[model samples]
Target: METDGNGSMEESRSKLLLYLKLAFLAMEPSNCLLSLAIEAGGGCITQQVQNFIVKECFAKNMKETTMNNQAYIKGILKKVIANVESSSVCAEDCLYEELAHYLTIGGPPEENNIIYREISFLSSDLDGKDCSNSVNLVAALRCSSNMLEGDTGCSLWPSSLFLSEVILSHPEMFSNKSCFEVGSGVGLVGIALSHVGASKVTLTDGDMSSLANMKANLELNKLCLDVASDPMHPCAQKVECRHLAWELASKAELQDQRPDIVLGADIIYNPECIPDLVRVFSILLDNDSFGEDKREAPSAYIATVIRNLDTFNYFLTVAGKSMLSVVDVTAKTQVPNLLPYMRSYDRSSVHLLRVSLLSE
Candidate 1:
């Protein structure tokens, strides 16, 4: 059976543009992009497709595409043009010039790669219907380039992604609530909190560098940093970043925040940090209103990837000692798969734990 040429062509266009959007923003290498190009051109990189890529995709961010990591762009462009020329398709002069520019100013491997990730909360637009022509936009994050380094909050973890999805899916739980996040990496969850109308959002990180990076990300998203001082400003984000080393953080300081809700992402990896983390929870959950209304009891929603069972068990034991109830609500809470476009994010890898104070 032969498929209709027009139907096939539309499918090709949709996939090509969809892949290009992913490629231009948050892709790793050019392998997927390369395959998409060939597939879109009906088994070869046609001159039309070549012009589309060079003119449409790579032309957008000249500085980001050419600078900092000229070597990275140079390598990708080299392979792409080689494939095109091999297929007997005449490559464009603009592509040749772009290649020349990178080859002339090649440098060492890029320590930092600036990435713009566009997350969409599409419900059922998966069949290429209403997907290619336009995107149902969500938050666009300027992820830190320094995420390559180990042991830094500069990276975006799956737990954070899961937590963000949870916040977006269930805005009622956080709206008008004072929210505090421990181990807030890159401030993605804070941004989500702001989106969901959290009355106050305070993000804390132990690492100084990661805290600075998180501030930059918030600014990139146009979220106000110091909402307390800039209260009158229309763009006040009600989001602030703080240096909170769990081991050294004082109970007096945590008590001052008086957050109604506590959030954490991927903060359960280290056994050493469990004691301080549980202690921080205890202090944050300690509120005078508990005597009056049990409904006012603060809750901690922790999203973590259980890498080690023993380490997670240690957290449970410590939380129990601190009179905290840790319940696994990953199954009961049905959070919409908001981030269906991000291929790298695995929702199943993350587990959501609801923690609350237990009566003594």
Candidate 2:
């Protein structure tokens, strides 16, 4: 009985450690982290658990995301230490030392606030033995410190990450096709599209700051944007960045850009923007509007996290009224979770919708 109990305790510890690792990777909520720490400590944080939290979780986050919340992190550490001491468990020395260092030296400089993240996609050979080979895409993104300061468009959202995975997993779908992305925040999806050899890629955002940042990121990856030109012609440039506000975009302009595939990530939040967004989609998907040749209609892949039921339903209703068909193709078009290491990202929360024009 003693041996069995020890084995059970060891199993629980192992599971808790795994949970902590995942929570750190996914950048989960602070409350979730606190709960994980308590659970890992078996209701009372021990010296070893505190050491792990400081070394593995906190240190790793600081390095990866340039997280400079010294005060917030220090508070969490103090709470944990207090809990451990109150429970008569010893706390780790290194945890207190790190906290003291933060309280003294302060957080990272405001200028160096941006974080550079490396997203890797593992590739396997036919034998499936050499699965270690992977492709890495690096993105320079601003932290979500201030959503009101146009930071919302500069931050990398989870839906964008999921959409990037989809593009990489099924390169054939995008390769040799003309692709255009709406609300191209941080330009990760655009980068992925270019990686898969999309014939022509155009990334557009309503926010000028986001457009500028997106252009910088594309250049950082050694990709050049084509000279700004008429939207009617197929982009001769490898990648193009355009400032396009859906509310102000004209129907003629949207119809002029004959793209094979339209893409968007996390752009369906506001109810007020639904009508304009659907109008843009309708014009883009109507291939017949281009000429009498009657080419195959273009399809759109929109990756969204439905936070509000009413807003999502409103989008569906508006889209349907605009003669657009929206289908949930998430299961049918499932892609490999190439980013298994990204625990902070809840892949299950993202839903993929395929949108096209209804047969007329």
Candidate 3:
């Protein structure tokens, strides 16, 4: 019985470690952190768990970026301290020391905060390799504290994360292909495409601020930004950033783009925008003029989280009317969970659709 009890405790601790790691990676809210810490401590705030939160999570996060919300960190520490006191557990000295440090530093900067996220992908190398063989792609993204800023394109959504994982997991599909992404928020998917050795990558967003932020992120990652005279031509540099509003984009301009693959992440939300979005898709995916080489035609991979049934159905209706066929390939395709540490990202909520122009 004592041995069984010991095993149970060990299992709980293991689970706690996973929860803590995920919470830190996903940058969960302060309240969520307090709850996770409590769970890590077996329903109480333990001193050891407090130390882990301070030394492992908070300290590491602070060092990773100067743009981190110091006030938010301080608040989380205070909550942890209060929880420890309430639970009759003594909090670590480092927690108080960090809280004092934050008090001196004051709040985060007024500018948008930049977060460096390391997205790891488990390598498909089947040479009897272990989990340690995974690869990490680090991206520097500027995101607003408020979710609605930059037309909501400045925020990192779960759909983008899911799409990025799909790209990384299926490198063969994107490698050496010319890929274009619409509504490329934060340019996470663009970075992923470059990592997978895409021959040419074009990232476009309708929002000016989002476009600027995406360009900054691309520059931060040291990926060259190519501005081509002909948007249809393959980019001279590995990545290209463009200001493309679906509603405003000219049909001639859309027809000029000759990408082999098209991609979008979380771009199917607005019901009003569905018509223009599908119109853009129609021009891009219509390869009847390019001859009957099916392999040469562009295919679209859209990752979207269906928040409203009406909005999604409306998109489908608009797409079908635009001579586009949308197929749900989320189950058909085996996309590995590359970002296992991102607990905040509900990949299950995202659905991958394969879109193409119907045969003439």
Instruction: Give the top-scoring candidate (TM-score).
Output: 3
lDDT, each prediction: 0.77, 0.77, 0.77
For candidate 2, report its TM-score.
Answer: 0.71
Using lDDT as the measure, what is the rank order of every candidate, best first? 1, 3, 2
The TM-score measured for candidate 3 stands at 0.83
- What does candidate 3's lDDT look like per residue over 198-281, in tens digits? 998989998898999899888777776644444443334668889999999997788777789999998998888999999888
lDDT of 1 by residue, 91-182 (tens): 87878887887677645465555555545444433554666434433555655556555635877788998998888778899999989999
> Residue 19 lDDT in model 3?
55
Cα error, candidate 2, residue 110 (Å): 5.2
**Model 1 per-residue lDDT at 92:** 79
Question: Which portions of model 1 miss their true places by more than 4 Å?
Answer: 1-12, 35-49, 62-66, 69-71, 82-94, 105-129, 132-151, 226-231, 235-237, 288-295
Candidate 1 structure lDDT: 0.77
User: How close is each model in CA RMSD to the real structure?
Assistant: 3.9, 6.2, 4.6
Candidate 3 lDDT at 97 equals 90
The better candidate by TM-score, 2 or 3, is 3
